[model samples]
Target: MTPAVAGASVQPDGALHAYARARLADGDGALGLAVASYRAALVQDPARVEIARRSYVQGLESGDRALALQSAALLDQVGMLPRDGTLLMIGEALTRKDWAGAETLVGRMVEEGNFAFIAPIVRSWIAIGEGRYAPPVIDSKDRFASLGLRYADEHIAFQALARRDLAAATPAIRRALAVRSSDGAALRLAFAGQLAAQGAKAEALMLLPVGSAGFASARVAIGKGKGLKAAGAAVTPAQGYARLLSRLAVDVGSDKAGGTLALRLARMATFADPAGAEPHILAARLLTLQGYAPGAITEAGKVPARSWYAPIAQAELIDALAAAGDEPAALMLARAQAAELGAEPERQVRLGRLLAEAKDFAGAAAAFRAAQAAYAPDQLPWTLLLFEGSALEQAKQWDEARAVLQRAAAMAPNEPLILNYLGYAQIERRENVEAALELLKKASALKPQDASITDSLGWAQFVTGNVEAAVPVLERAAAGAPTDITINEHLGDALWTAGRRYEARYAWAAASIYAEGDVAARLAAKSKEGLKPEYAAP
Candidate 1:
């Protein structure tokens, strides 16, 4: 499979061989190799739109900026530039100070009508670059009219503040923040940072609401009489363009199907303004969603410690580390975050969940208890009680677990999850069998389609010597959740009680497929020896 194409002397089949290699690498999740192979294929046959498109996407995913830009240029040459390509080309035009060229690209984007609401904002920036800045006309008839108006007011305020026109900036920024559809936290941080950058620290402090976690870094800086420098202010045309694209990346990412497109836009925004935090955050989230853990961590880590979104980025970075199979690092980071943000109950809860996932049940319970202590008495969350109780139970603290579970059950009396859990735990311990059966029945009624709750009810019946009743319910549970280990094992026990030895063995075999440790040994023993003779069926 050596190249045979003209000027491509490395492969026999040239582009075809390279394309096949790229697809194979991509299918194996080797994005770096995929991007390189795709680039080599495109080099052999520059007109291959499919190869160019794949190279462009993989380049962005793999954090290969050069390959992304090269493919974007190729897409533009073929007049088939995607949204991200159009944005990159406009950024290039802006860098070259080609206002007319940027506006021409905006015109093409408007004609396409996919995300045309942003065209006016892009044009406004281009005009500002051309020394002809003006307030954008809000089209009430536009599809994204509300969004357009919010950004329009935001830009007006930004320009006013840049010129030190306090009167105009005051009302414009207020109006923009009043809409609440756009990211108010980001807007506040940006506007406040702009004010600080302009030496109006007092005014910036006034704009940032008190006790806003997102503004923690900014508040500290402004309190120190230090001016906070933001990456984007809509003062420069390129910065304005990057700001809008980053916001667009966030907006587009709300749609589950638009992740890849959102990542492309986020990467393009980063390319335009490397220091902007929002685009990096958006890219991190998109990368996490796409299962690119290392890329997610890198993007999240890019947020400077002094950035307004630093806390959020730090949290996301910890999560990315856990997703990347570095739970020890994740736990270390989570513990540090909890210690630093002692008043934030959510951080403690996050730490608790991570500890539980790592099988440190006692540590998890302690973290959950800490979260509970951090919360005000009136604001105590029942969910935290549930988590703490579950952890304590796993740690073999039966009395404390029961007490905490009862408190959770009292707080959320009708919650099916709480009911199911409490019922299942009681049934397992052979405590208050009749009451546990009632709870399981209520939970089953609340969530009719829940196989787990149904399995609990069936198991309760079996342990109570209602073997005839248990057999049918366990069969139904097994059918509902065919591969669930617990459900299948319970079905085996119920079938064995009903004198169905062959069917019991079959059920045990199914459960054994995914069982491990002590459960695996127990299932294997049961499959060979059948039901114990401790008092068969009464």
Candidate 2:
């Protein structure tokens, strides 16, 4: 027995136990480490098919393609490969231009009843590559047909583009656009590029919807006679692979899976095109959304400095730093970006937001002022004015705050939040009582369920000698916002004025639980001595 210990004996039981423990301990946030630990465990017992399956998925999610491939090979040898593993293997074959191998894998996946909707697109692409035109047939009766139609049309257009058949591509693009009103951003961008390449510059520009700066920039590039050949085309194997990955990333990123799959796919895209900033930008955004700030920062840093996406990546990096509680670093980066951008109102607004978050109200106000100076008279966002007013209020510049808030209220007359804020500020200042009441009434009407607005309305009534009317409104506000200290405090004052001393004491006790600083002290005194006659309603 001792002599028979040839090489290293695989302890399947021990390895399986370790893998189970690691799986249990590895939470979603530490997925990268979990995948590595899984790989190490698998190495100890290579014949463990179940462990191999899990390792393959974890590797894909963590962007460890080699590990995924290795696990896939192991799973295939044991007849335990899942549909996803088969797809990955097929993708790898396609990447290497091994069309025969991809076809074989695709056949196996189809036989297993997996990804029935997607399998045909792979076949269609393969057929187009072989100089045969075989368009995918999507049955509308199929359960997945609605979801698959847009992807099918888009892929058909790509195949057409690969074959340099603009006539064929145009109709497919139109079919895709017809499937969903708001479904296409990347698709439209690619189609616009094709239009521009055909010398239809106005048509291309018209295709680009408003609010997409990326598409706008591409329109500018096309206008300069840069020709949309490169932008519109994905004929190369690498480009097709990257485009597929980006589409999958978008689909998966919208779910509760929290961007892990999206980030991995984007990472693969970067390997396909190192100079392309889109993949890196997508990865950075995914990481940020998943609360992996450090990872986001690293991905954002990978974008080329001269790339069109660099500024956007930099802004995301700054936001990531701020979200990660590195506010000082965020502020420093924002300031640098603002200086570099030079009178860009967007950057100025970003600087103001960062400063406001850091409690540097004066600095925030200054940044907002700079933004206001840069904007044309008619172009200022009401949000900009609101932020400026709030910052000035925080900085104790009351007159400036009032003036800014008034202008904001004028511009956004129907905005409930603006109305509520200005009205509450006026009430606190003990000036413009009638105007404040009117504003609060409008806000309450606009947002009937809003507890804060109701509280403000109730408090206004109390301050204006309508004690009985205040009591019911304050009661409703307190019911809606059971834990809001201000609402409870106002309810307590109203109850006291309505001659319900015991109920008032109970309300003050509730308010005390959430009170802090000066409010807490005031509540404590009120609870001890009840309200003084001076504080009671007339």
Candidate 3:
């Protein structure tokens, strides 16, 4: 008998041993080993629904579908399937063409008071499989109901195309598109396919949007006289099911329920259409959102080079690498893709960000400059300019940094972060004290709760000889960020200037705990001898 079939009768001590091993592996980030240990633990304690559920999630996150399925079976046996688990089982049933099983699972989902938001979409899939269409009830006040109505219309369009009812499909498609611009990619693709089926290849080509770039190969296949049926659109039940599932996955991923179920749904969509890069990209994004960076990288890396989504997937992989703290590898990969980076200003910006994170400030500044040069004047956003300026500042190109920052400030004068950074830089350099004070005040007003901005304001006041006025501001800043070395040090300075000698020494000692090198030495000297004449109150 397979491990899935084995009875749960092992001793408690044996189960505990396996569970401890699983916890150790998980803490070490040996996720594959952790999954194996979890499975072993579950086998030793088959009645432990918590262990089975955890094992199932680990299996899904690790891309071990077979293990996930086995765990799902165990969860079912123990009556512990959650909404997401029910969706997984339903997807599995749909993949196997077990329509009755999927319908039963859907009913179970509804009774559990879960997935009610997406029930209409699920029911539509069922209706499609049963060779019928369900008209969605539109409730403008209810967000999910609105989504259901839009999705129902799109599915109806697919049904119309399947039955060669182009006139009926066109209006339905139009209504679906009118619902939301973001949700129209699949609808647009399906409509284009239907047009191609009706011998309107030129019209279909014109109707294809940039979002349909992922389906370029399929479009080309259609143009070469392959019918919609041959190209895998709405011609067959399985193809239609895959397309619907892919769309549903996108919807679910963007919803408030979060990405766990969405990842599972996207995984199923990939199984339904392994040739499509869209589903893989969706799965990768959902995996990233779920904090499975390694899994995200793997899924994104699967997109073939010829597909339009390949570049997108590659970018996502780079982000996942950075998220996973493999910054050196991310930098190398970014450099390797330099040829592709030239045309993609956003990619260049991302490379700059990675370089910045790696502390290669000079390289980061150069990358930001390249991005700036590549972007059209109208395309340059304030954030990009701010990043370039920040990178230049870190690289110690002070003149260029100040100039770029001034330009960014001009563009986004009300941006608190920009105001704070620029103000702090000016104060640090002891240049234009009044101007810095004005900027800091503006920033403080915009974001009254920002400790850094508060600290800058107080530090400026202290440096400018307003010892009494600085005390309260610095105290607030210190209270908000008690462990922050700079804030603590500033608080110590202000306290000393206010004649609170004992408190100043105490604050300086606290600051010294987290300070380093020059700051640490300065705090130490201040703790022993008080503020020097230059820093002393007038």
Best by lDDT: 1
lDDT of 1 by residue, 232-283 (tens): 2446777677777776777678898888788887887777777777678777
Q: Model 2 residue 537 lDDT?
A: 24
Looking at candidate 2, the ten consecutive residues that score lowest on lDDT are: 1-10
lDDT string for model 2 (1-538, tens) is 1222234354555665556654764565566677777888778777877678778877765567777888889988978776556666766777777878878877987788746667667777667656688877877898878655657777777777766677887788788777534435545666677667776677677777543443556666777967466665555444555666666677778886737667666766665555556667777777778776776777788876644355677777887888778998989988987776333666788899999988899999989988787668788888889989999999999999999999999999999889998998888787898899899999999998999999999998888778988899999999999999888888998898789999998999998897898888888888888897544321
TM, every model: 0.81, 0.68, 0.79
lDDT of candidate 3 over 124-243, digit per residue (tens): 666777777664445567656755564667666767776777788777877877864764544455577677877767766765642233355546766786656543356333444455
Q: Which ten residues in a row have the lowest lDDT in candidate 3?
A: 209-218
Q: All candidates' lDDT scores? A: 0.80, 0.75, 0.73
Off by over 4 Å in 2: 1-34, 38-62, 66-276, 341-345, 369-379, 450-455, 458-538
List per-candidate RMSD values in Å: 4.7, 7.3, 5.5
Q: Which stretches of candidate 1 lie over 4 Å from their true place?
A: 1-21, 76-98, 110-113, 120-124, 132-188, 199-203, 206-216, 229-237, 251-258, 305-309, 341-343, 444-446, 457-481, 498-504, 533-538
